[model samples]
Target chain A: MDTEEIYREMANSIVSLDQEKAVHLANQALDESMDLLQVIEKGFGEGIRKVGDLWDEGEFFLPELMSGAQIMEKAVDIITPGLQSSGSERQSSGKVLLATIEGDIHSIGKTIVATMLKANGFQVVDLGTDVKAEKIVDEAIKGDIDIIGVSTLLTTTMVNQKKVIDLLNQKNIRNKFKVIFGGAPVTQGWVDECGADGYAENAVESVKLVKELIQ
Target chain B: MLFTNWLEDKSKIILFDGAMGTQLMNRDLEPGKIPDLLNIENPEVVKKVLASYYDAGSDMVQTCTFSSNVVSLNRHNISNLYQKINVEAINNIKAILPSEENLIVGDIGPSGEFRPPVGNASGDMWKAGFQKQAKILAPGIDLWHIETISDLQEMSAAIQGIKEVSEKPIIASMTYRKTKTRGFFTIMGDSVETCVTKLEEEKVDVIGTNCTLGSDQMIELIKELVNLTDIPISAKPNAGQPRLSGGNTLYDQPVEDYVNDIGQMIDLGVKIVGGCCGTTPTHIRKIRTLIDSR
Candidate 1:
């Protein structure tokens, strides 16, 4: 297959959740001497974006979204090391830390945001869920992270986003990194209440928000 | 004495629990806030409500600890206060009644998320949360009511925790959302047959249903459930569907309307019948009156 054809096959495989086919097509696309970024942009990114669109439009539900995301993750796993090992001059993006706040166990939303950001060339360090506020700030300080993304599904737990922000300010780390928040009960009002720099309604918007925050 | 044992030998039908959340909301619970916090911060209000439920003929009263899990508490900025929160939750429930016979079911509720390792809540975290809450609650509780559990993953975690410490009979129940306006499936898509088979392995003393659709819906689900297992079934349904009126949640079906439907749940082999969302002492009294006469 041609480069574009190979990339399209990889995208279809990921969307279809045929991990082996996705792996094969991605490897073929890479072997065809396609640009690494071009392969990722055409294949995994578009596949995940299509899955997200289907989810938003109710054509796909949670299980399908999960399967599609998992496929994209599998594809990325193989492609990432090749791209990194090649030492090619690539896009310059921002650094970000994302986590589901401590006491909240819902991490899927945060995972989606991190995946999309990473696919778009942002440096996203996923802290995982039930994360302590100190650990978040500590990571930011240690890694010199540019953005902190906190996710919480419960209305009561969303307060942790504010708590993390409060500790950052208390520890004299507020101005170090921009904070963005999202999840089920996280509103635009909550963004102001938590004193976060930005908020995204969904994963697709999170990339735009992170880019804007860094710029 | 086991409520189920007492229930099995007795000729009279059971007087199940009452509308815990609705009664709790009436006592000034904010939306999405842990209602069990009232048990600690304002014991008198919780006392009045429970006493009212008992007086209203509710033989069984669940403690105000549905959202008392550490995961849910941290949501409300009570992360460092897990022990205090649960201790107060138990003590407040103890303060409401004088004796062990009046069974205060320690409510071991869900974390509102998928189970861990694959999800965010690690099995260790879930166990730790349950252990901390149960350590304080087990001493005061006559029975540990693992109520409103939706998924098998969480139920397994909670059961594993309870068996580690307390020997109290744990009553496991789940909430089912009606897919077709009275479907026999849980919110997570587990059917009543699946629930019965899985719950049997967990070794819960009393297995049942609670906190979903109204009496009619509960009856439909229960009837479907009867074909699945011979396990002692408990049914505590909502008074009716929730409706938004004047910016407040209201169940259009009154106490009598709910009590009127109790017979159907009973006919479906519901061993224990009570109210859930819209129930109060008044509804329980009517239920008691209805059950006693039958």
Candidate 2:
């Protein structure tokens, strides 16, 4: 099958949450020995975007979306290095640090965004859950990350998202690292209230929003 | 009329607590993560809360071990220390008894991971997860409370594993997303009657719903459930509904509102009753006083 067909098939495996099938199709695409970049850009990236569309249309739930991202991440784990050596050259989008804010330990959403960003050619530093605001800013400053995305699944922890964003401005790093927020409790109103750079409904959109801002 | 010898001679549906996460929050636990760990990590706080339920109206205070399973423990980077933490958790609760006939229940909650048919989680993986905790807790607890269960497939497997580990009465509660709008079905579109039937088929000692929604929703489901099985029913709902404020998770339900309803549960023929999310000793105190008055 063509690389395009392979990518679509791979995307479907992700949607189906079929890790083995995803890996199988990705390996078949690899055997064709086609341009890995074309496979990733046309195949994986587009595949996940399609998955994102499913989420937007309400055809998919949180588990489905997260599984798709996991599939994509596993596939990338196998293919990214190969593409890097092929000379098509992966994009070196700036490094981004992401986490679920304090009082909220749910990381399924944040993990999805990290997976998508890495697939889309951005270096992402993930700090996991219940991350304090100071820890987030310190990482951003030390790493000089291009953007910091904060996730909060609970309302109690949502304030920490704002706290981290506010701390960013307080430390005069607001301009240095763009701040974004997302998660169940995080809303557009929250974004506006916290003076955040942007907010997305899911990890895929968060990746898109970050890419747009940095570009 | 599910038959449970909870008190040896008491013949009635069992009542469980409502909104533990909701209750703990009122006791000062921020939402997200394993708030149940307060049982060991802060037993003084946990003891005060559980003891209050005994004073208020609880025949049993479930030991804090809802997320004691390895899967939930892994969330707090305690996966490597699951055996140690879970054992300590149960031991701590057992240490501070009410000096009454009250029992200690070991709570087992969902793993939050997908299982076969929906996801790739293996039965062995799941059985291992529950067994690891149950084995450690069963010897200590008066009974094992398996709740917030979503998968029907794992219900029997969990019960069988627990039976292998302990002869303690295992009260199995499923977390169905019941609503007045959609009576007796879960968020995954499971019917309460069907779930209860499945649990009954497994012959679980006690069966009912916990987490998701509140007392009113649970009451609605029980209206259907109590009639379905002659077995005693269990209902542990949330603190009404969690409200998001200032980015912090809050349970806005009042204690009197909760206490005022224990009679309703009893009137509906509920045998056992306690609080879950928004419940504290104060709420249990009211429930106890109300029950005594009856």
Q: By lDDT, who's the top model here?
A: 1
lDDT of all predictions, in order shown?
A: 0.74, 0.70
- Candidate 1 regions with alpha-carbon error over 4 angstroms: A1-24, A30-67, A73-215, B2-4, B10-12, B98-101, B116-118, B178-189
Over B201-274, each residue of candidate 1 has an lDDT whose tens digit, in order, gives 98887688887678877777877878887777788887776543332446678677787778877776777777
DockQ scores for all the models shown? 0.08, 0.18
Q: Look at candidate 1 and tell me the lDDT of residue B29.
A: 67
lDDT for each residue of candidate 2 in B1-294, tens digit (9 for 90 to 100): 112355355543344444455456666675564666675477676666555565555666676677777776766667776776677776666666766466677878876555632356666777777788888887777777888787665666678777778887777877765333445454334566778778878877777667665777677666777788877666666657654556455566887776665567677766667666555566666666676666
lDDT of 1 by residue, A1-215 (tens): 67667767777886676878988866765676667777778867778777767655545444555667667777777776778778864464888899888866676678767766775667788998888888988988898899999988644456667878899889987898899988845667567756789888777678778888898
- Worst 10-residue stretch by lDDT in candidate 1 chain B? B241-250
Best candidate, DockQ-wise?
2
Candidate 1 clash pair list: A156-B75, A157-B75
TM-score of chain B of each: 0.91, 0.87
Q: How do the predictions measure up, each by TM-score?
A: 0.67, 0.71
Please give, as one word, the docking class of candidate 1. Answer: incorrect
Q: Per-residue CA lDDT of candidate 2, range A1-215, in tens? A: 66567777776777677889878766766676767766667777677777777765555545666667777778777776677667666667779899888877776667778877876778999999888999999988898789898887665567777788778777786888788988755666668877889988666678779879998
